[model samples]
Target: MSSSEPRPESGPTVPSVLTWGTWAAVVLVAAQLVLGILMLSGSWSLIEAHAGLGYAGTLAAVLAAVSAVVWKRRGGSAGVMAHAVAMPVLMIIQIGLGSAGVKWVHVVLGVLILIGLIGLPMSLRSARRQSL
Candidate 1:
Protein backbone atom coordinates (compact mmCIF):
# COMPACT_ATOMS: atom_id res chain seq x y z
CA MET A 1 0.00 0.00 0.00
CA SER A 2 2.51 2.59 -1.10
CA SER A 3 1.54 6.13 -2.07
CA SER A 4 2.79 5.43 -5.58
CA GLU A 5 0.62 2.32 -5.92
CA PRO A 6 -2.82 2.64 -7.36
CA ARG A 7 -5.93 1.75 -5.36
CA PRO A 8 -8.43 -0.70 -6.84
CA GLU A 9 -11.06 1.31 -8.65
CA SER A 10 -14.74 0.83 -7.81
CA GLY A 11 -16.63 0.69 -11.05
CA PRO A 12 -18.72 -1.38 -13.38
CA THR A 13 -17.58 -4.80 -14.53
CA VAL A 14 -18.96 -7.75 -16.48
CA PRO A 15 -21.02 -9.03 -13.58
CA SER A 16 -22.06 -5.53 -12.54
CA VAL A 17 -23.63 -5.16 -15.96
CA LEU A 18 -26.59 -6.94 -14.34
CA THR A 19 -27.21 -3.88 -12.23
CA TRP A 20 -27.31 -1.75 -15.36
CA GLY A 21 -29.79 -4.12 -16.95
CA THR A 22 -31.93 -4.08 -13.83
CA TRP A 23 -31.89 -0.31 -13.83
CA ALA A 24 -32.98 -0.27 -17.46
CA ALA A 25 -35.83 -2.64 -16.73
CA VAL A 26 -36.87 -0.56 -13.74
CA VAL A 27 -36.97 2.56 -15.88
CA LEU A 28 -39.00 0.87 -18.58
CA VAL A 29 -41.52 -0.46 -16.05
CA ALA A 30 -41.77 2.87 -14.27
CA ALA A 31 -42.38 4.65 -17.56
CA GLN A 32 -45.12 2.19 -18.49
CA LEU A 33 -46.76 2.63 -15.10
CA VAL A 34 -46.66 6.41 -15.42
CA LEU A 35 -48.12 6.21 -18.89
CA GLY A 36 -50.88 3.91 -17.69
CA ILE A 37 -51.71 6.26 -14.84
CA LEU A 38 -51.95 9.11 -17.34
CA MET A 39 -54.13 7.00 -19.58
CA LEU A 40 -56.49 6.44 -16.68
CA SER A 41 -56.58 10.17 -16.14
CA GLY A 42 -58.23 10.46 -19.59
CA SER A 43 -55.64 13.00 -20.55
CA TRP A 44 -53.28 10.68 -22.39
CA SER A 45 -53.11 7.50 -24.40
CA LEU A 46 -50.17 5.12 -24.42
CA ILE A 47 -51.50 1.59 -24.16
CA GLU A 48 -49.60 0.48 -27.24
CA ALA A 49 -46.41 2.09 -26.04
CA HIS A 50 -46.79 0.56 -22.61
CA ALA A 51 -47.36 -2.90 -24.07
CA GLY A 52 -44.31 -2.56 -26.30
CA LEU A 53 -42.10 -1.50 -23.42
CA GLY A 54 -42.99 -4.68 -21.56
CA TYR A 55 -40.84 -6.66 -23.97
CA ALA A 56 -37.90 -4.38 -23.34
CA GLY A 57 -38.24 -4.87 -19.61
CA THR A 58 -38.42 -8.62 -20.15
CA LEU A 59 -35.22 -8.56 -22.16
CA ALA A 60 -33.45 -6.52 -19.53
CA ALA A 61 -34.54 -8.93 -16.84
CA VAL A 62 -33.08 -11.82 -18.79
CA LEU A 63 -29.79 -10.00 -19.10
CA ALA A 64 -29.83 -9.21 -15.42
CA ALA A 65 -30.27 -12.88 -14.57
CA VAL A 66 -27.42 -13.81 -16.86
CA SER A 67 -25.28 -11.19 -15.25
CA ALA A 68 -26.08 -12.65 -11.87
CA VAL A 69 -24.92 -16.04 -13.12
CA VAL A 70 -21.70 -14.46 -14.31
CA TRP A 71 -21.25 -12.79 -10.95
CA LYS A 72 -21.73 -16.05 -9.08
CA ARG A 73 -19.39 -17.95 -11.39
CA ARG A 74 -16.80 -15.27 -10.85
CA GLY A 75 -17.10 -15.74 -7.09
CA GLY A 76 -18.64 -12.36 -6.50
CA SER A 77 -21.66 -12.83 -4.24
CA ALA A 78 -24.43 -15.36 -3.73
CA GLY A 79 -26.40 -13.22 -1.34
CA VAL A 80 -28.08 -11.16 -4.02
CA MET A 81 -28.20 -13.85 -6.65
CA ALA A 82 -31.77 -14.97 -5.86
CA HIS A 83 -33.10 -11.44 -6.13
CA ALA A 84 -31.38 -10.99 -9.49
CA VAL A 85 -32.78 -14.26 -10.74
CA ALA A 86 -36.31 -13.45 -9.60
CA MET A 87 -36.63 -10.35 -11.80
CA PRO A 88 -37.29 -12.16 -15.04
CA VAL A 89 -39.54 -14.74 -13.43
CA LEU A 90 -41.66 -12.04 -11.94
CA MET A 91 -41.84 -10.23 -15.28
CA ILE A 92 -42.89 -13.39 -17.06
CA ILE A 93 -45.70 -13.91 -14.58
CA GLN A 94 -46.73 -10.31 -14.92
CA ILE A 95 -46.88 -10.74 -18.68
CA GLY A 96 -49.14 -13.74 -18.31
CA LEU A 97 -51.43 -11.93 -15.93
CA GLY A 98 -51.65 -9.01 -18.31
CA SER A 99 -52.41 -11.22 -21.25
CA ALA A 100 -55.09 -13.15 -19.41
CA GLY A 101 -56.89 -9.92 -18.52
CA VAL A 102 -56.68 -10.76 -14.87
CA LYS A 103 -56.69 -7.19 -13.68
CA TRP A 104 -56.24 -7.96 -10.00
CA VAL A 105 -53.48 -10.45 -10.60
CA HIS A 106 -51.86 -8.22 -13.16
CA VAL A 107 -51.89 -5.24 -10.83
CA VAL A 108 -50.57 -7.25 -7.91
CA LEU A 109 -47.83 -8.81 -10.03
CA GLY A 110 -46.83 -5.45 -11.41
CA VAL A 111 -46.42 -4.05 -7.94
CA LEU A 112 -44.43 -7.08 -6.88
CA ILE A 113 -42.26 -6.90 -9.97
CA LEU A 114 -41.57 -3.23 -9.42
CA ILE A 115 -40.56 -3.91 -5.87
CA GLY A 116 -38.20 -6.66 -6.96
CA LEU A 117 -36.84 -4.62 -9.86
CA ILE A 118 -36.03 -1.75 -7.53
CA GLY A 119 -34.60 -4.04 -4.89
CA LEU A 120 -32.38 -5.96 -7.30
CA PRO A 121 -30.28 -2.90 -8.13
CA MET A 122 -30.01 -1.91 -4.51
CA SER A 123 -28.83 -5.44 -3.65
CA LEU A 124 -26.33 -5.22 -6.48
CA ARG A 125 -24.95 -2.00 -5.05
CA SER A 126 -24.79 -3.58 -1.64
CA ALA A 127 -22.97 -6.59 -3.01
CA ARG A 128 -20.44 -4.36 -4.70
CA ARG A 129 -19.91 -2.35 -1.55
CA GLN A 130 -19.45 -5.50 0.55
CA SER A 131 -16.70 -7.07 -1.48
CA LEU A 132 -16.41 -10.81 -1.11
Candidate 2:
Protein backbone atom coordinates (compact mmCIF):
# COMPACT_ATOMS: atom_id res chain seq x y z
CA MET A 1 0.00 0.00 0.00
CA SER A 2 1.33 3.42 -1.04
CA SER A 3 0.77 6.54 1.03
CA SER A 4 -0.96 8.18 -1.95
CA GLU A 5 -3.47 5.37 -2.19
CA PRO A 6 -6.57 5.28 -0.07
CA ARG A 7 -6.70 2.82 2.77
CA PRO A 8 -9.76 0.78 3.73
CA GLU A 9 -11.40 2.24 6.79
CA SER A 10 -12.10 -0.07 9.69
CA GLY A 11 -14.98 0.57 12.04
CA PRO A 12 -18.40 -0.70 13.11
CA THR A 13 -20.34 -2.18 10.23
CA VAL A 14 -24.14 -1.92 10.04
CA PRO A 15 -25.87 -4.90 11.67
CA SER A 16 -26.61 -7.44 8.97
CA VAL A 17 -29.24 -9.23 10.99
CA LEU A 18 -31.15 -5.99 11.53
CA THR A 19 -30.89 -4.93 7.90
CA TRP A 20 -31.89 -8.30 6.50
CA GLY A 21 -34.67 -8.78 9.01
CA THR A 22 -36.12 -5.32 8.39
CA TRP A 23 -36.14 -5.84 4.64
CA ALA A 24 -37.73 -9.23 5.10
CA ALA A 25 -40.43 -7.68 7.22
CA VAL A 26 -40.97 -4.97 4.62
CA VAL A 27 -41.41 -7.56 1.89
CA LEU A 28 -43.76 -9.62 3.98
CA VAL A 29 -45.86 -6.61 4.90
CA ALA A 30 -46.04 -5.40 1.30
CA ALA A 31 -47.11 -8.83 0.15
CA GLN A 32 -49.72 -8.95 2.87
CA LEU A 33 -51.04 -5.59 1.69
CA VAL A 34 -51.39 -6.93 -1.83
CA LEU A 35 -53.05 -10.11 -0.66
CA GLY A 36 -55.37 -8.02 1.48
CA ILE A 37 -56.34 -5.78 -1.42
CA LEU A 38 -57.11 -8.82 -3.51
CA MET A 39 -59.24 -10.36 -0.78
CA LEU A 40 -61.12 -7.09 -0.38
CA SER A 41 -61.69 -7.14 -4.12
CA GLY A 42 -63.56 -10.47 -3.77
CA SER A 43 -60.65 -12.89 -4.04
CA TRP A 44 -61.35 -14.58 -0.73
CA SER A 45 -59.21 -17.56 -1.71
CA LEU A 46 -56.04 -15.56 -0.89
CA ILE A 47 -57.01 -15.24 2.76
CA GLU A 48 -55.03 -18.28 3.82
CA ALA A 49 -51.84 -17.03 2.24
CA HIS A 50 -52.38 -13.54 3.64
CA ALA A 51 -52.87 -14.84 7.16
CA GLY A 52 -49.79 -17.04 6.90
CA LEU A 53 -47.63 -14.12 5.75
CA GLY A 54 -48.94 -11.95 8.59
CA TYR A 55 -47.53 -14.42 11.12
CA ALA A 56 -44.23 -14.52 9.28
CA GLY A 57 -44.13 -10.73 9.23
CA THR A 58 -44.68 -10.63 12.97
CA LEU A 59 -41.84 -13.09 13.51
CA ALA A 60 -39.58 -11.01 11.34
CA ALA A 61 -40.50 -7.86 13.28
CA VAL A 62 -39.68 -9.55 16.56
CA LEU A 63 -36.34 -10.72 15.24
CA ALA A 64 -35.54 -7.26 13.96
CA ALA A 65 -36.42 -5.79 17.35
CA VAL A 66 -34.04 -8.23 19.02
CA SER A 67 -31.31 -7.31 16.57
CA ALA A 68 -31.94 -3.63 17.25
CA VAL A 69 -31.53 -4.22 20.94
CA VAL A 70 -28.26 -5.95 20.26
CA TRP A 71 -27.18 -3.06 18.10
CA LYS A 72 -28.08 -0.53 20.81
CA ARG A 73 -26.06 -2.52 23.30
CA ARG A 74 -23.14 -2.14 20.93
CA GLY A 75 -23.48 1.69 20.76
CA GLY A 76 -26.30 2.14 18.27
CA SER A 77 -28.85 4.98 18.20
CA ALA A 78 -31.57 5.06 20.88
CA GLY A 79 -34.19 6.29 18.42
CA VAL A 80 -33.47 3.41 16.10
CA MET A 81 -33.75 1.04 19.01
CA ALA A 82 -37.14 2.46 19.94
CA HIS A 83 -38.37 2.24 16.37
CA ALA A 84 -37.25 -1.35 16.13
CA VAL A 85 -38.95 -2.27 19.37
CA ALA A 86 -42.20 -0.62 18.31
CA MET A 87 -42.44 -2.61 15.09
CA PRO A 88 -43.25 -5.90 16.77
CA VAL A 89 -45.73 -4.36 19.17
CA LEU A 90 -47.58 -2.74 16.32
CA MET A 91 -47.53 -6.02 14.44
CA ILE A 92 -49.07 -7.87 17.35
CA ILE A 93 -51.92 -5.40 17.57
CA GLN A 94 -52.33 -5.54 13.83
CA ILE A 95 -52.62 -9.29 14.10
CA GLY A 96 -55.22 -9.07 16.80
CA LEU A 97 -57.25 -6.57 14.78
CA GLY A 98 -57.19 -8.91 11.82
CA SER A 99 -58.22 -11.86 13.95
CA ALA A 100 -61.10 -9.87 15.45
CA GLY A 101 -62.52 -9.09 12.00
CA VAL A 102 -61.91 -5.34 12.17
CA LYS A 103 -61.03 -5.06 8.51
CA TRP A 104 -60.71 -1.28 8.10
CA VAL A 105 -58.54 -0.66 11.16
CA HIS A 106 -56.49 -3.68 10.33
CA VAL A 107 -55.89 -2.40 6.83
CA VAL A 108 -54.95 1.08 8.04
CA LEU A 109 -52.60 -0.29 10.64
CA GLY A 110 -51.07 -2.65 8.15
CA VAL A 111 -50.21 0.28 5.90
CA LEU A 112 -48.64 2.15 8.76
CA ILE A 113 -46.66 -0.92 9.78
CA LEU A 114 -45.46 -1.39 6.24
CA ILE A 115 -44.25 2.22 6.16
CA GLY A 116 -42.41 1.73 9.43
CA LEU A 117 -40.79 -1.49 8.29
CA ILE A 118 -39.60 0.18 5.13
CA GLY A 119 -38.13 3.10 7.08
CA LEU A 120 -36.07 0.93 9.43
CA PRO A 121 -33.41 -0.06 6.92
CA MET A 122 -33.12 3.46 5.61
CA SER A 123 -32.61 4.75 9.14
CA LEU A 124 -29.95 2.10 9.79
CA ARG A 125 -28.08 3.07 6.65
CA SER A 126 -28.26 6.76 7.54
CA ALA A 127 -26.89 6.07 10.99
CA ARG A 128 -24.06 4.05 9.48
CA ARG A 129 -23.13 6.88 7.15
CA GLN A 130 -23.22 9.43 9.95
CA SER A 131 -21.00 7.23 12.08
CA LEU A 132 -18.47 6.92 9.30
Best by lDDT: 2
Report the C-alpha lDDT of model 1 over 1-132, residue by residue, as the tens digit. Answer: 764433455333336478788899999998877776676677445767877888898899899888888777766567677777878888888888877888677776787788878888778777766552
For candidate 2, list the clashing residue pairs, or say none: none
Q: What shift in Å separates residue 97 of candidate 1 from its native position after superposition? A: 0.8
Task: Give candidate 2's TM-score.
Answer: 0.89
CA deviation > 4 Å runs, candidate 2? 1-11
TM-score of each: 0.82, 0.89
Worst 10 residues of 2 by lDDT: 3-12
Per-candidate Cα lDDT values, in order, are: 0.76, 0.87
Q: How big is the positional error of residue 51 in model 1, measured in Å on the Cα after superposition?
A: 1.1
lDDT of 1 at 23: 91
Instruction: Give one digit per residue, the lDDT tens place, for model 2 in 35-107.
Output: 9999999999998999999999889889989988887886777788899999999999998999999999999
